[model samples]
Target chain A: MNPAAPRPAEPSASAQAVTELLERSRALTTPALRAAVGRLAPPMDTVAAYHFGWIDADGRPTEADSGKAVRPALALLSAEAAGAAAEVGVPGAVAVELVHNFSLLHDDLMDGDEQRRHRDTVWKVHGPAQAILVGDALFALAGELILAAGDDATAARAARRLAAASRQLIDGQAQDIAFEHRERVSVDECLTMEGNKTGALLACAASIGAVLGGADERLADALDTYGRHLGLAFQAVDDLLGIWGDPRSTGKLTWSDLRQRKKSLPVVAAMAADGPAAGRLTALLTADAKKSREEFEDFDEAEFAARAALIEEAGGRQWTADEARRQYDTAVGALAGVELPAATRERLTALADFVVVRSK
Target chain B: MNPAAPRPAEPSASAQAVTELLERSRALTTPALRAAVGRLAPPMDTVAAYHFGWIDADGRPTEADSGKAVRPALALLSAEAAGAAAEVGVPGAVAVELVHNFSLLHDDLMDGDEQRRHRDTVWKVHGPAQAILVGDALFALAGELILAAGDDATAARAARRLAAASRQLIDGQAQDIAFEHRERVSVDECLTMEGNKTGALLACAASIGAVLGGADERLADALDTYGRHLGLAFQAVDDLLGIWGDPRSTGKLTWSDLRQRKKSLPVVAAMAADGPAAGRLTALLTADAKKSREEFEDFDEAEFAARAALIEEAGGRQWTADEARRQYDTAVGALAGVELPAATRERLTALADFVVVRSK
Candidate 1:
């Protein structure tokens, strides 16, 4: 049930392709990347090192448990799907991964949660000020990395897209902080916020692949849309699993969204309720500190179960997940439209499936 | 009496050229930079507007303050000193000025400052998160701005110098922060820290200009040293004025550093307790809250007289100002060493003098 173990795709041909796709990503992040990453700013040198599991908390070299480089994998796969090889996307892949890690470090701090990827969050270990600077340094380095790629035109366009994405992300983060103070959350409202928070960078990731793969603006835009959909689906599924899945399996505590009063998709959807469970949940939440941790825990246990039922009843969760799956499928389908090698197309489709079906 | 009025300079031929040199920096910024700042990211867009006084607290457009654009002036002047025309250093000028403002915004926030350039600080209105983000966006834009410049090699070199200086500045800031937690200070420590905190960027300003102006690396390095000296001198003079000058003339609260217990140059120099004044001052600071505002105000009323007497006793203020002037002259002399048009050389010399003598 642990999400950390490397998963094998089924014995089917598609599964073998996905396994190869994953391997391609892993292989592409070769020894040269370690040398390249060494040239990054010290702030990121440390943060990236830690995030990649090159070193443990005491600065010792544990070199274990960095998350699957999913974004980079997608980038490489998309490049292959566009008929270019993985080498074309390698530099851009590193940049995309740096951006992804940068987001994780900052978002973890902003959200005030402790754990990330089965370890203490950067802020928990480094403190917020250092963590914030680390994130900033990483962000700067990410843009710099993108700027360092191939030709004048390619690097310039990539840098522009990356900078625009970075700005949108800051705006999205501002909205999230604002969200904490508001009383009501609508489905559409959170959707836009989620899109900015998650969708923007994913879109950029896809665009980067297309750009490196030599796709034109039209195809890049399509890839961008594909990435956007994939990101939305990824976050929605993540939110779903957070409140329902086994902690041991997901490596995240269940009912954490409700316990933390996080403005997640289901929570926002559940707030629109007008029935018995809704009243009970609202009164329980509003009733205050008189509610014991045991009581609150008990409430969350039943409430999330009811909330899951309510999500189904409202057609909200199903629709969102369906939309997410649709995006995933479309993202995979978009590969077919681009001129690509058969092996590359097959691998990309499998990677897309592997992303959604990820238990963690 | 107007803070805006130009300070009188020595009537040398070089001095006569100063006004025109200063004017050229303004020429570089206004129309050209008007379009540039408009395109910055939000936290940065708002900040670029704020630093330039194009917008107010509510994000509404207001009259622009046109901050003398000193950093840009320094850069362009360095280029001029090195025989490069205005067009040659335009991007460096804009980029350095932007960086200068970025640092100012962050420094003001951490210092709990409420005002800047006779206007409310960005953080005083937009809050710290936005302020932090604004500084960050400016940093990003600063890097991007370099790319839009003279040639690929020059742009790359400027970026390298800038990014390196940025790391040094952060290190300096961290050291400055460390100085606060430990209740000790000395003249040497103050000078080095201030050199890093303020002087580094000022030095970079001149260096960027020189590099862009096609000054040789050795000459650029010399200008950097010269600029650092000027920066230190400028800061020392500013500290003196901050404590004793008329608020109307300085556009800052009298004894502002004393009131805030800021570890400014004079305070650092005086911490050696060269006389009874140092001891009494230290006692007053440590027991600051116990003192009546009237007592502090009376000390303020007597500050110019007290500071003059104490500085004379310690030979502190005179030594610092003399040291500053020495550096300023050295910086200007480096430009003289460069082959230059006599008039352009004169303007740079004049600009150096202007930097030391400006009231606000």
Candidate 2:
């Protein structure tokens, strides 16, 4: 979005490789995921199926976007990093995916998001009650899947990890909601919120496969660190896209996060910068928020465009872009600490790169 | 409300014994429960603490009713039934309690209930978002607790049982909500819904301790049957209280279920009866529902009292009372099929009796 920010040229080969990995992971994970969801009772199962894009709202089969399945890919690759076949991580992959979707379902409702992946959100389609129940059902399924995947000790350990991460993720959401009512939030506070909201689950997804495959804690910890850094990079890119990415590509409205008055990285960083542009941006946002309190649809595209320019002028966009690159390198560096196979390490690096650079 | 419905006499000795059992179970479970909740991050822990009545809205310590601890007592007794110390069932007891409270937190929000236990509901005190997140956190804690309770096999078995029952519980809620919009719900359908909603969890609570203590499935099955019947009895009594119990004792308004237009057992059974009173009751309910759709809170005390009298005259009150007694006998009979210590059997019978006859 910022002309001064360096854009990494996408190598077609690396992009193709990551695409293949994601597809393979989805292929391995979908059957199990569908099976787990199928276990939900009637009407709930139908609502969940619609949310997953496996069927239309009318109950007929249809193909639609079901997210990138990034978490599942990480899980499968993590198992291989632990010296097991990808199939060994199928349960973990499915569990991570279920948890991810569960969060998506709830977050969309809480955030009042009407659309996801260019389709109506579950709450918009099925009403808030069903959305809440289906999300809860998916979470329960994740716990069941992880607990049944291995022997008692392994299952217990994995369940504990998932539970801890899920708690952090929920806590992060609580903080994010709290931040919306405040006038100012520091960069450090924003980072902490993002770390819990995004980093914890990604870390769990990366290490859970190793835990399920019986890898030692050292290897799992290394993968966790790798995924944590990758999540920061991923979220930074997401913040940038929320402001400036094309609505068609992002499958979201222009300035989506700003519309919700989210205290995401770009806004927090912009306000932290020292400049007249920052002050002007702050004054504009403060006034707009007051108006929004009475009439929520007060902002127009022109206003959002002006705010985006002010953010770039104040260095928020460039700083966020730089931060994404820095975190991506740190994530790749984390892999050097562990003794993974050369192919596994390369695949992990490629996946991290893809996450930081993808359009959606 | 109906003069013809027989009231079961409460024997002081049995009441005292059941109260002691509940107290002992709570004493054993509260510490572990507190410890688990203490692990939640800031603000969430506080919200949960308030919900549990450990603290009031302002965060000061307070002693308030934390339910009857019925499920925990059942769990401990089931463990003893399996030849294990009551201590062995503490984890299962704690998990079941957490799940029960989790459901309450979410249900209060979904049902828009503002009062519970003679105090404000969590959603009313905190916002809906916090209510949702805290409920989710509690549910996750439950899975973790049960999985960590015993050896891998035992933990996994217990988790599966809990998950199955949780799903049924959720499904029953969905059915209940659906029934609210329907014109007529058959009595059989109402029973099935109640079985899934209430019976499943009670059955799990009755058998989980046995499962954790490594008891055979046959014994667990017997206990499951006992709890299932007891749950039906328990629900029947709850349905009665929903309509006619004193507000001071029940912590609910008069005709609370009727206010929400819930087609509970009384209404469903009354509709099924053949008589002029049944026809008049149905006509009044349908007209009231239509009025309620346009402006809720349209019905006054006089109209509700009239409807209650009609329901009683239609034989709903007597039928539900007879059904509660029938289910109580069936539950007690199920206990006889399994070999139990005479004292354990007596305690179980007393607890069931307590449940069927409690004021709240």
Candidate 3:
């Protein structure tokens, strides 16, 4: 659990191979995303460009970090798994990335998150109305990209998959918001919400590429299952980091999730632990609720530290870490059922490691 | 300009014909829209059902009036003009209606409108965040509806048209929001904004049906032009009613546009008049600005009445009325070269008249 603890090293050959593939995937897909977004009219286009960190607020082009392009990498890999060239799946990759960013844009506005990636969010800079519309434009563009992909049946099939994922994503988002108002949220509900929020799009990303690459329905389903488990693992690991990871490395505030009282996996797991730690955690949260909203903003640093320590002591930290590993193994096992090229299978396995391990 | 005044009568035959067609179109398309929306997951689907007035807040099925389904009628008519069966355009009709409602859901939230159609807005009934997500789900469903229609080529083309229109719609909405902060907005600018906001979707509805019905590119373009002109006429007439028409019939507050200081067509025309009446209107509006936000909410009825009188005196009311009729004529004229059936042409013409001459 300690940050400085040593971890086992990955087999160097596959690790370097996947790293190369990921970089190459980004190289091909970033331009495709830019082209897709360029189809939008100004101000929305400009807002999107700013949100993607391709430009400054004033519309001047700037070279800034966009993101990991993880969804696109998964998409390209899935295409390769289907025995097709990755270029054939560029449209699918773009759609998945756009949907991911669309969710981020709306989530930032809805959550009133002023800063993302150490910069002002689109809503914060351009205002909520513009942010809302630009998000809609990106969503529309994502659908359009898939609809325009290739032949009719394939494009329609791909769009259908994307649409279903989008609906689930929205449903998941609504549930998450609704859950905030409830007095008690069960672990099952939390997991289902996570599946909808984080897992649906990733599953779509994984399967859509395969579908477009001419994979049969069963193989695409397998990949979707793999991605779903991978998404759960990724969220689990993220929850662990929220509690115990170094703020300097994570680029977030200390105990950021606790400060916001986010019902993340670790927090939920600890709440359901039924131990004295859960009792203390509940009392602390309830007492914190009596504070005014402004008081919550200036949450006590020592209280947050205490809460994190309690969650760790309740075994939530360990449980979630183990769950992440379990999901990661299951995800990797999913790839074995499909007849993929040896290189593709190795890359996928390495990508699974990259998601769960977090330690380089 | 008075609400109680009588208007010129429409030819009974065409009016009856178009009315029957609109009813038939709604009968065919409403079920399809409901079915499409039903495909979305619960909670999102429930919110959408509430938005469509199909259900109440308690999730009980209720007999509520949906809107006029004007976009669907236009779609069906365009298909008929293209020598296709109305049934062939049902998917396009459903898609347009979905997109229209999507805009309404978002617009209501953005504008903080509390009521619509004598019922609470979705955001008021549920929550803003839920309303936003439901709007998104509906939007995704709209694209999926088109993509999954009948054949690949037609569906893709229709989806592309809808996507382009959606972008313009967002642009129009952004401009409308931005215009609220401006000291002066030109009539031309107002028209363009309305074109993007109102006309774009209507134009897409008109053309997409024809395109899906196998109309040639030129014919589809003609229908699009017709719908754009008709949308402008519709908005112009609606603007006139916003100030001078009876709130009882309009289902809005008295002098609603003036109360909100909305730069509707009449307001922009009066602002650009450069006459004594315009000067008086400016002085009154400037004085209104001195009032606090709460004071604006408690605006004096006499002051609103005086603003309306000043706009009418500045020739704004008459200019907009004439413009609406002029646009209606131009829209009807657009059908002249399309070689539509005489009955279809008459119905389209009658629909144009109905848009501009909204006596009720």
Candidate 4:
């Protein structure tokens, strides 16, 4: 540290701007999201309401924690960057949110996740059949919402982007499932899978606003690249939190990812590392498989915590943290090629920083 | 007696025309369907290929039993009815076939069905996770294929119809699930569910070609009506087959739907009959429920056969047969309102007849 340099002030201007933008975006996007979901069939409508944390399992209205609305915010912000009214991007925001929820609903079922947002997942509360169908409904509704936009050209372009992204998202999910049964997954393969599973949707969300706002292809593509990198950074941060974050903050059980033996980015990278720690970690994983099924089932929280520590010792934690920073920087750099409004650029930079820095 | 009445020729003119139409439609539509599915990412692409019986689970190219391609034929025929060449409806055909496969994939998972089209279902072969994902991929691809059509209006209209039908289909599936837990379901409710589950997609298929062909709303809607009633007739025939069908011809085990205790139309109607036979059927059902879980599990084919006989004795078989004919008549009546080429009209009539009479 430079002895002459003063400490930065608290509540930095960028942080304040991001917080306000998130707040404003959510305020506008939520209503549109709700309206779009309301168009689902009654069965899906009920499950979706519960899944979105807008209602309790009994169908009574309740306030529960929902997601941060980052993708929707990106859609609206991208529209603003293209010099269009943010309100014009509301449908795009709604479409992205719907697609996001569709993936969440189906992914939770496929992954057998029991809890989300500190509440029972839709599959747990409503059952897997309903969860599956509602997910399908939401996927269809996402397209319907985009087509609801008045201009045929805009709707067609937005729908095409979403359809392409969804195909990539499903492919990514298939790859993820396949990776589970595999003993080895290359770091490159993992990154590509993550790009498709997470990055594709975010890229679509970012480009949707531009497509709807009639931005030129170059600017839209640039924004999409920015979002893809941002998504990579976001996922890396999520992987770190999965292993190290407090359960209370993360809304999951202690060492949840470790207990499930999820081949998350950091773990995959560490497993591929050429070091004693990597060998030891591999031995531990193989040893667990060799144990009696009952023994594997009886493994405790302490064992999971130890596995997390061992992963960190293998250099995974630091590697992923550094990777997150690199991706964040690259994402921010992509914005430089496009001439966005000053405020839009500031908000986007803040968003990129937020993706890597959030606690949960 | 009508012994003096002459028997009609076996292969009626309409039947001959429809057979030729179906064959021609398949030749055109299969290529388009293949192209659309080819766009899916790997894993899903592979599973989907297996599901469509184009390949084996080991990815070897093998011929397998696929569905009758009825929906695609209806789509192309309807396009012809609306004064467009069959080639003009290929996209609509592809879209309907994709959606049909999507439903089959998900429904197999939900129902825990082990076999389809004389082979292991996708869920059984590729695992449920991949089946679910591949279904999702097909659904997305369906939308993409429709939107890939050059005209914005046609794409938007076709996409909107598909989205609406998907919503209804999901709702019907939910109702079918709900009906399983109930002691009794009325005939009206069963009809409505069947209409949604089967009719909605068929209606969309029938109307899509017309919509894309720029047919007037009145003619388009009439064809849709025709398709809906045909679907109802088809379901009624399916219920009849569930209890009385020959296993060899149906490609299913003896009384398969009865073994599963599906609340098929005939069963629901029989349960509501005002007769002593209905009382006996009710007693049989209650007796099955009253037995211990082990005792229920011990019941064998004889018991299932007895139950089927009782249902038939209760007049379910006769009522459903009559209802199928009623719906078939109504479907044909709807077609009479729409002007069409004689060949197209003959093909449509043959299709409606075929739906009610198909053995598998």
Which candidate has the top score in lDDT?
2
Residue A73, candidate 3: C-alpha displacement in angstroms: 2.1
Colliding residue pairs in candidate 1: none
Residue pairs with backbone atoms closer than 3 Å in model 4 (clashes)? none
DockQ for all candidate structures vs. native: 0.18, 0.50, 0.50, 0.56
- Once superposed on the true structure, which residue ranges of model 2 sit more than 4 Å away at CA? A1-10, A57-60, A274-297, A300-306, A339-341, B1-10, B213-216, B274-289, B293-297, B300-306, B337-342
lDDT per residue (tens digit) for residues B181-218 in model 3: 77789999999999999989888988888888988889
Best of the two (1, 4) by TM-score: 4
- The candidate with the higher lDDT, 2 or 4, is 2
| lDDT, candidate 4, at A272 | 86
Assess the local accuracy of residue B224 in candidate 3 as a C-alpha lDDT between 0 and 100: 93
TM-score of chain B of each: 0.85, 0.96, 0.96, 0.94
Error of 4 at A314 (Å): 5.4
Model 2: lDDT to the true structure: 0.86
B191-247 per-residue lDDT for model 1 (tens digits): 877887778888888788878887778878877877777777677777767665677
Q: lDDT by residue for model 4 over B26-45, one digit each (tens)? A: 89998888877887777677
Candidate 2 local lDDT, A113-190, one digit each (tens): 888777888999998888888898888888878878888778777777887788788878878887888888998888
In model 3, chain B matches the true chain B with a TM-score of: 0.96
Quote each prediction's TM-score: 0.74, 0.91, 0.88, 0.90
